[model samples]
Target chain A: MTGHPQSSMPGQKISIQASQLGKTYEHPAGSVVALRDLSFQVHAGEFFCVLGPSGCGKSTLLHLLSGLESPSTGAVTIKPTSVGMVFQEHALFPWMTLERNLSFILDQQAPAQQAANRQLARRWLQKVGLEKFQHAYPHQVSGGMRQRAAVARSFAVQPALLLMDEPFVHLDYQTRMQLQQMLLTLWQEVGCSVVFVTHDIEEAVLLADRLMIMSRHPGTAKTVLQNDLPRPRHLLDLKTNARFIDLVEQSIGVIRDELQAVD
Target chain B: MRMKDFAIRTLAPLGAFLLWELCSRSGLLDARFFPPPSIILYHLIMISPGEGIFRDIGASLSRIVLGYSAGCGAGIATGMVMGLSRRTRDLLYPLVAMLYPIPKIAVLPLIMLIFGIGEMSKIMVVFIGSFFLVLINTLHGVVGIARIHHQVARVYRISRRAYLRHVVLPGAAPAIFAGLKLAIGYSLVIVVAAEFSGADAGIGYLIWQSWETFSLKSMYAGLFVIALLGALFAYALEWLERRLIPWRDDRDTREHHDA
Candidate 1:
């Protein structure tokens, strides 16, 4: 399916582009293809979500875009931009405190602005409601809070592009909702392009400016749905809204069809 | 609960001491060889000034400290090389494997021949014992760190110095510290063995001298000090480990269980 370039911020410039991307991992037995012929572009300030079933190579796609993994077939071209990424495991330095975790990124991103980075680190921690926990190590905090810190860290760098590979997948439902809202609020403030990968249809519907539905294993972009849900979406309100449920069901229908086709 | 723990902790050792005293006093064991704790204490006080027990302790301690530091420094540097580079690991692993298991004291005669029967030979024995233990542990620690950290370092574009300082060091700290603790015990064993084989003034020399002269009480006193040193070193390292890696203790209970 082709992306319609549906965006919340109209006339925003292109932030990332990838064409005919593919990734293959070779084991002792043989080579396994993870992704193939996947093409997508992310607009500036756009919240682009990739939705797929597990093992669909949604993560491989994100890794390729973020330059964490190289595609054997094609290339990903970022628009001379800095990219920040959040992994599914939160991946905060276990040895460092929450403040240092954020400052580690900030200090590297803006070494010349040391004092400013320290202040920004504290402010970012506060934004995630973790100012009190700035001195606490990553292991000292709950799994949910660590992921919050991870989000804060990605946003703290002020990258033009952010790649999130199932950041909320390991979190429980309650923490997941809280983090999603926190992410949306932070994303609004930063206004960077985000390529969020998730298998959950409801999350894709809620967060995506344009959602790419991916087919199972050796994933290809099968459908691209433009989310027409109104802005400033809250989880509680969106659950009750008819249009929100319709969008969710429509995305679910696409995934359901893919599952049946696999059978 | 606290009272129960205290009671068990104190009573167990105290009870053992009382039983030992009773056995020795009642002539159940040879008093000459297994003197009562009080006699050992008395000999400890008598030898404190005349025989210079403190000087012997100082001598042994200096050897251990110097040897341990040198071994640790070399071990960490070599282990880093082996852990970070495949070529170094390939070159060093076989050599290390061949040398590591050979009892360090077996080479004491050789070390004495080369370095002479002075402090150098004793120190070298301790150094070899600690070096191999710490190097193997440090290598394992460095190699065992999760790949997630390497990816994180690349993604964030952390400087090489900062990556080693922050991520690599701390990630491998627990393992390295474990190695250090084990190395300390090994150091003590080798130093004592080296001294017993040949030395003028050390705890090991003192113990051997007392035994040769048939001063059983002083021998027991020396034994007491050696036991006390082992406990003290273990406690000291445990304290340092807690301070350095405080988060390890606070880590999730489930994760601790898994480990």
Candidate 2:
């Protein structure tokens, strides 16, 4: 049932490669080691989740991949193409209208496509159920709505690799579930590589094709686990599916052990 | 409730005026110094457009516009330079900090010597008054821009010109407008005081001339006009500010939703 063309290939194309990535932040008090000698690869059209506890550098890995920050000691390689990011903060330009926020990224097209790009923006906003709020400012919307807008904005860019740092972490459970499904649907439609960072084990299980778990205190990708949960998995179906529960429990067990080891 | 709010708002000033009128009419207060609101209004009308009041107002406005525009232009430019470039900020910030607190009135004697007690001197005084206020506020605004904004811009690979145009300018606008508001009030005060030191035509000159001749009523009229001008200036700035910061009022909605 996997109709995703890129993933259908037996030898999946490596879209992103990180090698010995390290980040150390220096403050007045002392130095803080964020990520140490981290390395990973994300396949084309893959939903790759980076799972870890807080300060375990899941976000640092996203940053390095997105080139939002330079690694202190390593390199990341990506197939030359457009990239989009949905930060935990949403980072929607508050001064702009929602339509304008999406257009700011979308409207970077040829003069002929300018009108089409705008229409595309409206279509994407409609997909996120924000068509009516296209003119509203960021502060005028609810947190869930703003996150949806942020998600819509990122997807509107039609990026080759979409890096998201727990975009739904701040939403309520119902909102989070709804957004997660919306994101998965959009991901399948776009077929772009995603490197989503989150701390929630259930979220990781729900969304990822495979997930990397990072160990705390001088963080490193401790393990990479595969999720063989069947495709087109409904949100409610995951609750009763034994394999889904097993995957979540396995991830939680590993994380718990890592937390204990760190202490 | 709305009507009551309006009534309450209107009555405070009206009540004060009535008490002042009673005090003056009953001879309980000195009319020479503390004239009733009616006597001040009568003198105000007598010195309206046909009289020298319009000329004084026009002269004061021209000086303010000229001085305030020059100062704001210079301040915003230099402040942006200081904000974006550390070298410039390091070089100029100390000097600005040292000079910012020195009253423009204190420099009037020196300015008069350089610009020679003419319109240039008065304008210079007003310029100095506004320049520091705008420069400091604009610098603070730019420096206070969130790191996340820069990260977002970089991640998007936005052009330097576009970043400045879209992000920096709008981000700094609220603080810049605040500075402008303060500058306008400061310019008004400085221009008036500068006129008093030496000027032939201005509200400050009118007030000074009236005081010298013991024309209490005209002095009160000049004061009233200046007060009105101040209110108008403040109201205009606030109106402009509201237009620039469209997100400000929406913050109430966000906070309400949060609660």
Best by DockQ: 2
DockQ per candidate, 2 decimals:
0.50, 0.62
CA shift at B117, candidate 2, in angstroms? 0.7
Per-candidate TM vs. native? 0.93, 0.94
Judged by whole-model lDDT over C-alpha atoms, candidate 2 comes out at 0.85
Candidate 2, residues A149-218, lDDT tens digits: the string is 8999888888989999999888889989999999998988999999999998899998999988888788
Clashes of each: 0, 0
Put down candidate 1 lDDT per residue, B1-259, tens digits, no spaces.
9999779878976898889999999999888778889888887987655888888888899999999989988988788779888899999899999999999999999999999999999888888888998899999989988988888888889999888888888988998999899999888888877888678888898889988999888788888888889978998998899999977874668465433
Report the C-alpha lDDT of model 1 over A1-263, residue by residue, as the tens digit. Answer: 43332332556677777777888899999998888887777787889999998888998887778777888987777884687889998499888899988898788878899889989999999999999999988777788988999998888888889999899999899999999998998888888889999989889888988899988667888878889887887877898799989988888888786677875
Q: In model 2, where do residues sit more than 4 Å from their true spots?
A: A1-10, A109-112, A261-263, B1-11, B47-51
DockQ of structure 1: 0.50
Give the share of true interchain contacts found in each model.
0.50, 0.47
The single-chain TM-score for chain B of candidate 1 is 0.93
